[model samples]
Target: MPLSSRLPILLACVVALGGCAGHPKGVMSPVAVSNKTGGSKVDMLVVTSRVPSDDPATLFTGERSPHPYLTDISVSIPSDSKRKAGTVQWPKKLPPNPDTDFAVTRVQQLKSVDQGRTWFRAHVVGGHALVFVHGFNNRYEDSVFRFAQIIHDSGAKVTPILFTWPSRASLFDYNYDKESTNYSRVAFEQTLRTLANDPNVKDITVMAHSMGTWLAMESLRQMAIRDGRVAPKIDNVILASPDIDVDVFARQWTEMGEKRPKFTIFVSQDDRALAASRFISGDVQRLGAINPADEPYRSKLEQAGITVIDLTKVKGGDSLNHGKFAESPQIVQLIGQRLVTGQTLTDSNVSLGQGVTAVIAGGV
Candidate 1:
């Protein structure tokens, strides 16, 4: 065949290969990933209730009901270079080198957290562990990268574990995400129980974002209902940009009762994301966007024994203002050093560290 005759066939083949490359690569569990920010390799353990997708080549892509399966993975994230909070960046494509783009290096399978605990022991602080539950619109990779960013930014030695639910990973999937979160309640409880029951884990901190807060609270509430008390190992709870309804949150707290972990709720009146969520859900006030300076609202939360950090006044990073607790460098410092370490935070502490004048209601 002449050069002209072969050119069209070669071009067609190249185009087909490129199309296949863009499709889902499928799930690779127990994968090892390198971290560019800290220049280290970290392990990410996943516990999910999502069913296996037909694209079994990829991990956890099915939209079916909660059949609940657990996977442990490791991956490297893009480096911050700036070493500041609220500044995490992800690459558009997976590359050969983590320095170039985020990609998984290795993967291995594990039966349960027993194997994970071995890895967890190395990161524990004073025998403490940190459990993070991610919110709506998150895929497995998105959850892993965000968790790694938070852990790296916090500079805390505590072991970090992520509980990821089946999020449709779409803005239009709000209702689907809500149902998926609710469905994963039992599985989330199991993840907590695994940590709580482990003798190696003496103290634990639970953090949840957006819709994950609802799942975390409901899971704990269910455990409390069954055991008649919250786990003593759970020493602290952090709810960042929680998308729960104010009234529903009050009821959830009531169900869980007292003797719970020290509760910290990060709220911002200017959170446009939560504002949109409110508009979607019948115009009810979502918890994350609540103004702490309000008359009865502040009093109600304080009475419930919850600590509310109002971020309406603080500036820098996250224009939407829905993720300041983890995204804001100043607040991330507060969370990494004080919150996870079990240090009591006050107005002076905020001023001394972040140098921002914040409106903090309900605290010691």
Candidate 2:
């Protein structure tokens, strides 16, 4: 059936699945992240194009903004839970509970920095920063805790930053999210350029998931086009289950020339979420769900020198199989061990488990 006819059904399905158990809300924790190096409390920096809520009752809302803003925050994970990547356990309690085990605290604006150094000097070092651009339907609080979770789980020693574009935070808002991703490209570009040019930041690793991958690609391509060169400090580009048209991805890459960062794409053929996205996109295969073993897709990725990993067989805790990159322990361990080290995911250098397969740029 056509999407027009199935729109109501799709919306209903989305609403049913939109419930996130143990999602964080309200006032953040006041505990200092300095208490533990890799302990429960984690400090995270936020860069967002979402408009701040006018009412003080709400810090930020699901509205889009013309300009970008930066914030620093501290998020605390449950002490009983493991700090492993690809794993998340929400507190037993629901919202409106101040005593909830997990909290996001200590949020302050980055008003000034001494000689380009962030307020959290311990987190920023060796000129390294890790930026995570979130996927579709994420709200302000969602992005903050997610990035904090990622930073804590990955054991990354660099500064943790999250770039949040405005999301309608609704299951039925797919079209709106797509347009919002495009609309936030300018602010995203500005954030990247600022990080790249900062003397305190020697290099930056960017990770984008779902629709954020589309925005990230467009922003980087636009930056390259306008500046006549890409930033060398933009070292690693990791896309997790990208919900983008393969053809558009190729065009974005082609426009960047040969100076772009090493590309790592995480794909899964069993991603039902991408299947829905493909349906919505008029049956155009999403870049994340393409089978690397197949023709055309494999050939195109090889030609473009993009590293594609096939994680279809890996059984994840998440039922959708869409967020394995951040929800699978094995993949998260792999990311922590290899990808974050600024190492290339070439055939000769990579190690894979029984289910995971690596398709290098030079061929299988």
The weakest ten consecutive residues by lDDT in model 1 span 17-26
Per-candidate TM equals 0.83, 0.89
lDDT of 1 by residue, 18-117 (tens): 2322323333333344332455555666666766654423566626444455555566655566234465445443333466344565654456566767
Q: Summarize candidate 2's per-residue lDDT along 252-312 as a digit string, tens digits.
A: 9989877888889999998877887887777898999989879988778788778888889
Q: Please give the lDDT score at residue 293 for candidate 2.
A: 76
lDDT of each: 0.71, 0.75
Clashes of 1: 16
Q: State candidate 1's TM-score.
A: 0.83
Off by over 4 Å in 2: 14-38, 54-58, 80-85, 94-100, 112-117, 120-122, 347-349, 352-354
RMSD (Å) of each candidate, 1 decimal: 10.3, 3.2
